[model samples]
Target: MFYEIVTSPCYGTVEKVAIDKDSRIYEWEPLFAIKNMNGELEVIKMGCSGEVQSLEVEAGDKVIPGMVLAYIQEDILIGGSD
Candidate 1:
């Protein structure tokens, strides 16, 4: 029923992509691995269970905090909606 965009938690360069577009991912699933400025791998996690709509960044791409990496589509059950 809504979309959730996954973002980088800190300034870093995208090191790896663990998921692809149209991929179904669960809560806390790793979306990407980023190498921080201090040379650390930070694994970004999905906050909700949904289907990946798109990937906005690729491996070796620079990123900053709040930079969107991918979009997730999650269905919200309404009150007896048709």
Candidate 2:
């Protein structure tokens, strides 16, 4: 099953894509800054606080729902033997 992650609070552009499966970190990067509710600009590191499987799109990609931007490789075995 694939999930769609929306852009939170609306921002300029996506800087990077982070992938995480089953609470395990797979990839990460520094994302572009976004203006919060308080009107403050802030750059958020992708997947800094939550478990993400994979990013659907890339940097500067216009995104919408029902779009298969990226994919998550599920069923990864432990001990790095997949």
Q: TM-score of each candidate?
A: 0.89, 0.31
- lDDT tens digits, residue span 1-82, model 2: 4342434444334444444333433334433344444556544443433345655456555433344533333333348555
Runs in model 2 deviating more than 4 A are: 1-15, 20-56, 76-82
Model 2 lDDT at residue 82: 50
Candidate 1 regions exceeding 4 Å error are 77-82
lDDT of each: 0.91, 0.43
Question: Highest lDDT: which candidate?
Answer: 1
Candidate 1 per-residue lDDT, tens place, 16-75, comes to: 999989989988888899999999999999668889899999999999999999989975
**Which candidate has the top score in TM-score?**
1
The CA lDDT at 25 in model 1 is 93
Residue pairs in clash, model 1: 1-74, 1-75
Model 1 residue 65 distance off true place after TM-score fit, in angstroms = 1.0
